[model samples]
Structures are given as structure tokens and as C-alpha cells.
Target: MRVELDEERRAQLPPTWQRAFDWAEESLGGRVVAWEAQPRWRPACFFELEREGEILPLYWRGARGEWHRNTRPLEREMHVIEVFERNGISVPTRFGLCEDPPGLILSRIPGRFSLDTATDEAHRRKVLDEYLAQLARIHSIPIEEFEAIGYRRPESPEQSCLGETRGFERSYRATKTRPDPMIEFQLGWCHRNVPKDRPELSFVVCDAGQFMFDDEGLTGLLDFELAYIGDYAADLAALRTRDLTEPIGQLGDAMRRYSELSGREIDFGVIDYHTIRFALINPLSVAGMVTDPLPQANYVQYLAWYVCYGRVGLELMAASTAVELDPPSLPEERPSRRSVAHVHLTELLDPAQAGDDGERAYQLDRMQRTAVYLDRADRYGEALESDDLDDVATLLGRRPSTWQEADAALEELVLSSSPERDPEFIRYFHRRLSREEALLYPVLREQQGIAVPPLE
Candidate 1:
């Protein structure tokens, strides 16, 4: 059945975005008979239509808004996909480019999105091996090929290592409204610890290990939004981060196999540094959005990444520095007067109750998640704020009644303080972020068990 959008929901789309869908329909000379929007931080939708008596599945991936942008433009993504297609890399075929709202029309890859989807061990291994080999293939592409198409090549080793991250930090700072001690401290730490002995730059997928796989093998590599010239070790480190969620077998074994295929030594030190660096991208991208998200933004998804991956960055930092961390205990749960009302709201909005209508189910799922967050916040927000104030007082020698004041004071201290105080700041921020993880625990329950795999 077609996923129909009501008039109210259709009215929410800006004229430009509405035209983007029209552009895709007109370009293909077919009506969009079935469609559903995929709501993961980015704005993407899947459309199905009968063209020339053949059902064509197409994906229309759009930008959130001009206010939030990827490192490269949308046209660049299409070009990169073409490059991958030419170089024998398995990637989704580009159908067309959407100009009005800045998006791409791509043929939907046919396979499960993760290797773990294979029930048999041998099948999983077969797919994992091919995925790693495909990753090596991506890195093996000469830097000049990418540079020929306007992709920037690093001028030096330091630039190769820190260039993209520095750009991310600048964007974070430009739009930053509130003081984030965890983000600030991590930024300072990353800036201080750029890898010196990094390998010659290669065209690495900055967010690697995302592909569609099945019994045969990987169907197509998905997403080129963050592809750029960087150290190969950065790609390996990003794979480790993906392992947290995608379950890609033993990462150390994956690294060893990748080394054999690419003929490059596995630099655990560089991987270690990059693990933290890569994880920081999550919180950095969402810090402003988490603080003040736009109306159309996926606020819960932003929060999910901020805490889940943000904790990965912190844990990696602790591991690299040999600091022992103690995750804070959840404070006593005392339900407020509004907790029952929140429970009722979430139950009413439950996606499972929406039955066969997929679009309604998806919208209900988002609303239910929001309800769960509000319920948890109403119950535990005060205790968490009090705990934060205590942590701030421990660091700054004075307690602030509100979390906002505490954040400002702690951030000022982080900016003005010396590196010698990093361990203390790290400890403090870890405890504070742990509290957030606890508060948002209901929404992020599925991701709670995800941990960055070891490089060794």
C-alpha cells in the first residue's frame, strides 16, 4: 500500500523540498506510487514507482537545511559515487541529482544494511571479508584521482591528520550557543594530540563500514557524504566505531586482514588517536542541535548520537591516557506528578498501535520516543541537575543552582585552564555525560550496549 501523507503533513514541507520530490517524479517520467521518508538525522526518503513496466526503487536523500551542512556539497557526493562506480568499488548507482533542495537521487541498494543480518557464521564472515576488502579497495584509489575532481589533497602529514577535524571544530564553534565542557575539553585534547607518524594520505571514507550485504556478499557501499583524503588509519578507526553497532566480527582481526590486503602496517597508536577523533564528530555535529534544535530536526536522533557516540569519545580518551573511569550510578527514581500523564501519552502514540500504515507508524515512533524522553526528563532531570551542580562545584569551588550556570562556569574553567588539568576535566565531564546517558536511557536503550572495539 502507498504511504499517504495527510494535508497537514504535506503542508510542513517547504516549497523547495516539495519540488525536489516533483523533480524526481518528473525526471523518471513516473508517478511516485509508494514512498516513505527515512528519518535518521538527515532527510532521506524511499520512493517506488513503475517505469516502463518495471518497478524502480529510488532514494531521495536531502539535506537538513542550509543551516546544517555536510563537509562537501551534494553535487560532490554524486561525483564521488561516479568515481567509486568507475573504480570497481561497489556503491549505489546514481540516477540523478536534485537541485532545488540540494539532494541526490540514487538507486536503492538491494541487501541488508549490516553483516550481522546473516544468520549463519560463515555467511557473516564471507560478507565481512568482502566488506573489509572493499574498504581496502576504497583506500587503494590514488589520491590524484580524487584530487582531479576538486577533492582537496592534504599538503602535509599534519594537514592530512588534523585538517578535517579542525574544519569540524570551526563549524561547531561558529554555531555554538552554550558552553559544553565535554565537547570543549575533547576538542582541546584532540588538538593537542595530532598523530605525527601518519601514513601518506589516501581517499578514506571518513565514516567507513556502512554498506548493504547479503548471503552472496556486499551489495553496495552506501553514503559518501564524508568521503575525503585522510590517513588510512582514520578509516580503520572509523570501522572500529561502526563495529560498536554493526557487529563486524573481531576488529583486531579485521585490521590484520585489511593490512594484508592493502599492504600497510596497522598503526595502533594512530588508530587510537583517530578513534577518539572520529567519535568526537558525533557530539560536535549535534552539540548546537541538541542545545537548540530546529522544528523539523530529529532532536531525539541528535540526542542519541550525542550521548552514545559522545561517550565513546570520552572512553577512548580515558583508555589512551590510562585513566580509570567510574560511570556514575543512576540516582533514585522518584516519579513526579506528570510521569503518569507522560506514560499515557507515549502509550497512545506507540508505533505498534499504528498497524499496517508504515508512514503513520514512523511518525508515531518519533512521537513516542519524544514522549519517553519527556517522561524520563520529568522524573530524573532534577536529580541529574543537582548532581551536575555538585560536579561543577567540585571543579570550580562554588555550586551553581542551575545546570546552565554550572555549564558556563565549567566551560570558562576548561577554556582558561592548562592541559595539566585535562584528566580532572575528563573525569568531571565523564561523570556529567554519564548522567545524561542515564536520563536519556529509555530512548537510547538499544544503543546502550554499544562499545568501541579494540584496535589491538
Candidate 2:
């Protein structure tokens, strides 16, 4: 049982990272005996160490490269975890940081990743209650404690509610390759509707509701890459998004549990606002990746995430503002001349061709999915573009002939519009986003049913 990597996955990591396991072994004064990379967009691995006749299961959590907008340095993450552990928050014991590849080494916490694997409904409720209690403890941590560690304290009520939202918007604008009216609308709407009376702030795991759990209860809260100082409602808003994928127990009941544990009144309005803001993150963080992907980039994952979460943001906006939206009717896909080529490409790149090489198979699966998306586009692309331009024409008082022209005109309108126009903008973007959703429906059907769970 020696640490090793298959040729395909090994080539994907940076040259410097090839020795990351050895570095972790040396750091811990142990021998690396076994390791396997976690199959996700980011680079991370689980490995076991042998030290002084005992074996320790450890994890090396890697950074999401500089390209990612919503990530922190590995050192900062280590410090954050240390603070959380000091404050009695359930977290893995940090071993040290790997400087070469930029990751953290820690004792592996044992548990399943989500509540979706609970033995039964009773088990799910019990684990969820325990998780909500942990969330309350997290929100209750003293602001000064985190402030002492260099987490910025919000100076005003606006900063308390809108600070993270502003940061996300800046990231989106800086990295986006093209005009995105949907993102623009969300930014404008959030800025205009910032909860002015927000007086409370806490150290929030900005990407909250991510933790590991066992039959007994939560093993540890994981992933602090996006932690920040902000309104606690932001964390609750994150749980709503997580509920879409992880099936967290009912949010309304969870809110009651959080309110009881934290001894603070829950503000449904603030949570609603944050839900809209929170949903923007999925699309924004992956915008740069989708537009200019790296060789190892999980292109289809980012594309599905953008289409699915972008639509979720708009739907949340509609519900919050009482806007009723009608899904656009798609014209039957007329197969384009290149349609047969797409079918051929999917067959050529099928994941089954990769055989037992897990990494190769994963990459092929993504390639095949890309072909499927393109096939859908070939069949329906023209009709969808026509629908989009028509919607833009309705908003801007003139039709734009091309997708680029439509995006430019619609984004211009979004920037200059007032909050009073939010309903119309939400409706327009909702219909527009639904088309993308429909195109990627085969690969991402589960995400389509995601609705913002009621807070009250």
C-alpha cells in the first residue's frame, strides 16, 4: 500500500503537486502508505499515514487555484479551522499546510457527506436538528474573536447586509467574459434592496450547510474557503441552496430550531434577500471557468451549475417580489446540419471507452455530456435565440438581431433600471434562464425542481 497515482490523473496535477503526498508524510513525521484523489473540480486527496506503529487516516484539502473568486489562501483556512476548533466547534484537527501545492493536511473526520443517506426520516430529523444546533453555535461565536484573527468587521449596517453581496458582484464583473443581464439584474436588485436595519453581524461560513455526519450526529463542519464576517441570515440563505442538492430537512422547521438555539429573532425578509444573493454565487464563481476552461476544468459541471443556479436565483427573486413567471414555450428542435456530427462525437467519446481508469472515465463522461448539450443547442439554438431577442426587444423597445446584441442591450437596461422595474426584469430573465435549463435538462434534471424553501 504505497501512495501512487494513475498516469491520467497524475498528469492533471501541477508538477510541484506530484510530491504533495511526500511533503505531507514528512510534515507529520510519518510514511504515506495509501492515497486516492477525490474526484471533483478541485484538487484534494485522502491518504493514510503510518507513524510509530500506528496508522492515521488523514486528508489533504487543496486550494481552488487563483482563478476561483470565492476562495481564500490555505493558511487562512487553516487559521479559521484552528479558531473554530478553539471555540468548541466540531472540526478536524489541523496537521499543517502544504506550501508546494497549497493545501491543508488534517485528521480525516469520519462520516457520510450529506443527510440524503440517513437511515430513515427519523434519523434525518435528528441529524438535521444537531446540524442546526451547530449552526447556531457557529453564529454565536464572538465577533471580536474572529476580528482579532483579521476577519474584517463590517463598519455599517449596509456592510453588514450587503458586504458579501458587493464582493461577489465585483468578482462576477471582473471575471465575466460577456455581458450577463441576469447577473446584472441580481446585482442591481440586491444593492437597491439591502436591509438597512441589519444591526447584527457574525462570522459566517459563507458557503454554509456543508458538513459531514454519522448515524449519531454531525462529525464536523467542512469547507471554510468562503467563510467571512457577515449577517447570520446569509448562512441560513446558504442552507436553502444546499437544500436544493443535499435534501436538508425542511427549512421552516430548521429556522425555528436556529432561532431557539441562538436566542435571536429570525428575519424572513433578510433571509429572502440573502437567498437571491446566495444563488448568484454558483453562476458567478464558475463564469470564468466556463468561458475559459483549463485543460482539467470540469466544463460540463460548471455549465450545468451556471444554468441551474442562475435560474434558481431568478426564481427566488420572483418569489420574494411576488412576480408570477410563465416558462417560455420552446419550438420543436429542428436538427441542424451538424446534428449528426454531435451524435457521432458523443458515441466516440463515451465514458465506457475509458474502461477502468476512473479519472479517464470521468473526463470522458464530461466530454459526452458536452456533446449532448451541443446537440440540444443545434436542435433548439436558433429558436432560443429568437425568443431571447424578442424578450430584449420588449424590454428595450427595440429588437436586437444577435445574442451578443441582446445581452448588451438587456444588461444596459438592467444597470439603468430602478427597483420598481424588478418584477419585469425578473420575469424576463426567468424565462431566458429557463431555456438554458431546458437545454441542459437531461444532465441536470434534479436541479430544476429546486425552489427556495419558505423561511417562516
Candidate 3:
């Protein structure tokens, strides 16, 4: 790949498109004949480009806006990919980095980037095995390479657990514009519980189980923006987040296979530590969007799922630590406050009323999610206040008059807590937090998203 640029054409191109024609021609030495914008968040500027009488599927290293403000640029991933490539792992090839805006042009691999395509028993086992093995192989990569790619190594063995914690803090602090006491608490807990024993650092994908597969076999792993040098166990825990949608295989079996491939004993506690740490990131990121309120096309569904994701992570964290939970109390019923026009608009926006299958699903998700939120608000809006007041009063010495007052009081308590002690208080708050999230699950489940309930 050469560093040639057509300033005239580049200026005329769209940022989201990454100026496909000029980019392909300049980066690949090909005349672009066809291309289309693939559906994706941040667009990934993902494209199926045809040039020089062939198809070159591609991805941009950087996204245009704030959708994923924390994405590690493709420019950075280029070096990481080289490290993986040297290690004999499967990944997309970097054609070149664009000179002007510095985007990475990549050659896309074959296969649908999903788990739904695998139909038969053989297909499922083979694909799952390959996926797990690939992850294990990543952990086996020499730790020295991480440094060459700008990844930092922890000074001590035990501190290695804090690797991803740094990234989580960075994201949470940057995205959160207001008070986030639970996130603040979770971050504190992660810091206090750095898992024992220092395992060899591997190039772990902080967000794992995302890859592509064709009819023939598994292709390259996808999205290395979150790749880092840490305990491979971090990679194991990451799969829990994905388990809702693209689960690799049975967790117990996957663990057994991973232990075999890496040739190192696995630590369940370390995995638990990393899993809880990883889960906390969900609430941090989602709470930012939720509080600020994005004008998303499917805002209701987004809010429900966002809240659910946070809830699930907290529940998993509790389970990882062997904390028991009582069933969450049901919300008290009430009358609707929304006008008839509001209800009509919700019905009118149904996917069945308009849009393509994908768009329709998007619309229907929005509608369903909106209905859930509205219905919940109507049923327990007042009760939610009463419950929070009670919980706040229980946590604090007295009840606060306003929701904001209660929030501030709870936050003060969280921030001022002894990081090393108070097991009972921790369990109590964790359950209260889980119950709080339970309020959002019905809508989240109704949206037809994949979910992994607490593992019994």
C-alpha cells in the first residue's frame, strides 16, 4: 500500500463513507466499481467494495461520532493486528492507513459475523471449539509483543488484574457527566479485589466471542479495539457479556477446553474478578447514555436493554462472590398518565405499520420498549419513589425529601465507605441494586434480546 492522496476527491467524499472511491483507489491501487454501507453502529464505515474485478470487504479503523466515543482507533489496532498476525492468529489484513484523516483500510474476511448461521450439531461444535481454541491461542502469545504494540504490562503479578480496570475507569470517567455512585462503588470494589496469583499475561480481547464464519469454516476474530495485555481469564469472563447473543459453547466445557489448549491451570476466582470488572463497564457506559438521553431511533429499547445489561452485570458479580439474593418485589399497579395521543403515536410507530424487516424490527423494538417503560412507570412510578425512599432511609439514618436528595445521600454513603470491609453492607446494597435492575428486565426480555439468567 502506497501513501498517495487525491486531495480534490477526498474533500468531496463523505466522512461516514470514508470516501470509499478515493480511499480504495489510493490504498489498494484498484478502480472502485461498486460498494455499499454496511449496517453497523459507528458505521465501522464497513463496506463491501468491488475493485479491480474483485470484492474487497473492508472496515475503517475509526468511527466518526460519539456513538462509541471510547473506541481504540483503527490506527492503533493496526499495530495490535501485526502482533496477532505474527502470532499466527486469524484477523483482518490491514491494507494501509489513509494519509489524510489516518483511517485504516482492511481486507474483510469471509463469513457472516454471527452465531445464528451455524445450523447442524457438527457445525456448532466445530465452530465453538475453534472459537475457544482461538481465544486460548491468543493468551498463549508471548507477553513481550504487547509492549511493542503500545500495551502496558502491570509491574507486579497480582496487579495484573487491574489491567482492564484502568480502561474501565477511563471510559466511565470520560462518558459520565454527572454523579454515578454505583459505578463509583463498583470501580472501588474492583480495585480492592485484585485477584491473587500472577498468571502469564496474554493478549486478551476485553470484548470477546465476536468473529465471522463462512459455510466452510471460522474466519478471523473481529473488533480488537479493546485488546490488551492481561490475564487470559479476562477473555474468559468477557464471553459472559456475549453469552446473551453469541455464546461460544457450554461454559463448563469451554473452560475445560481452554485449560487444555493454554496448557495452564485456570483460576475460577480470577475469572470471577475479571467478569465482575467487565460487567461494571456496562452500567458505566449505559448510564451515561441513559442520563443524557440520546435521540436514538429506538431509544426505549436502548434504555431498557441498557438498564438490563447493567442489572445482569451486578447479578453476575453477586453470584461470582456467592452472595444470595431474595426475589425482587413486584411493582404496585396504577393508572396510565400518558394521553390518548401519546398511546396512538406509539401504535403508529409499530414496525408492522412500516419499514423493512430490519427497520421494522428496530421500530417494533422501540415500540415494545416504550410500552414497557411507560407501563412500568404507570404501575410503579410512585412505588419506585417509595421503595427508593425506604432503601435510602435504611441505608442512611433518615429519609430525604427529593429523589435527587436520596441519590446524593446514597452516593455520599458509597463514596465514603471503607473499601476493605463491610461484607454485610455490601451484600445488602448489591441486592438492592439487583432488585432495582429487576424493574427493567421484563421490557428487556420482551425486546427479544438474548439473555443469560443467573446460572442457577
lDDT of 3: 0.65
TM-score of each: 0.92, 0.93, 0.83
> Residues 174-289, candidate 1, lDDT per residue (tens digit)?
99987887888888888888877675878978888888976687798887777789888888888888888777788888889889988988878788888888988989888888
Per-residue lDDT, model 1, residue 67, is: 26
Provide the lowest-lDDT 10-residue window in model 3: 1-10
lDDT of each: 0.80, 0.80, 0.65
Which digits, one per residue and each the tens of the lDDT, describe model 2 over residues 119-175?
A: 899988888888788889888889888888778988888888875666767877787
The regions of model 2 sitting more than 4 angstroms off are 1-17, 65-72
Q: To one decimal, what is the Cα RMSD in angstroms of model 3 from the true structure?
A: 5.1
Q: How accurate is candidate 1 locally (lDDT)?
A: 0.80
After superposition, the stretches of candidate 1 with alpha carbons farther than 4 Å from their true spots are 1-18, 64-72
At residue 248, what lDDT does model 2 achieve? Answer: 85
Best by TM-score: 2
Specify the poorest-scoring 10-residue window by lDDT in model 2. 65-74
RMSD of each: 3.0, 2.7, 5.1
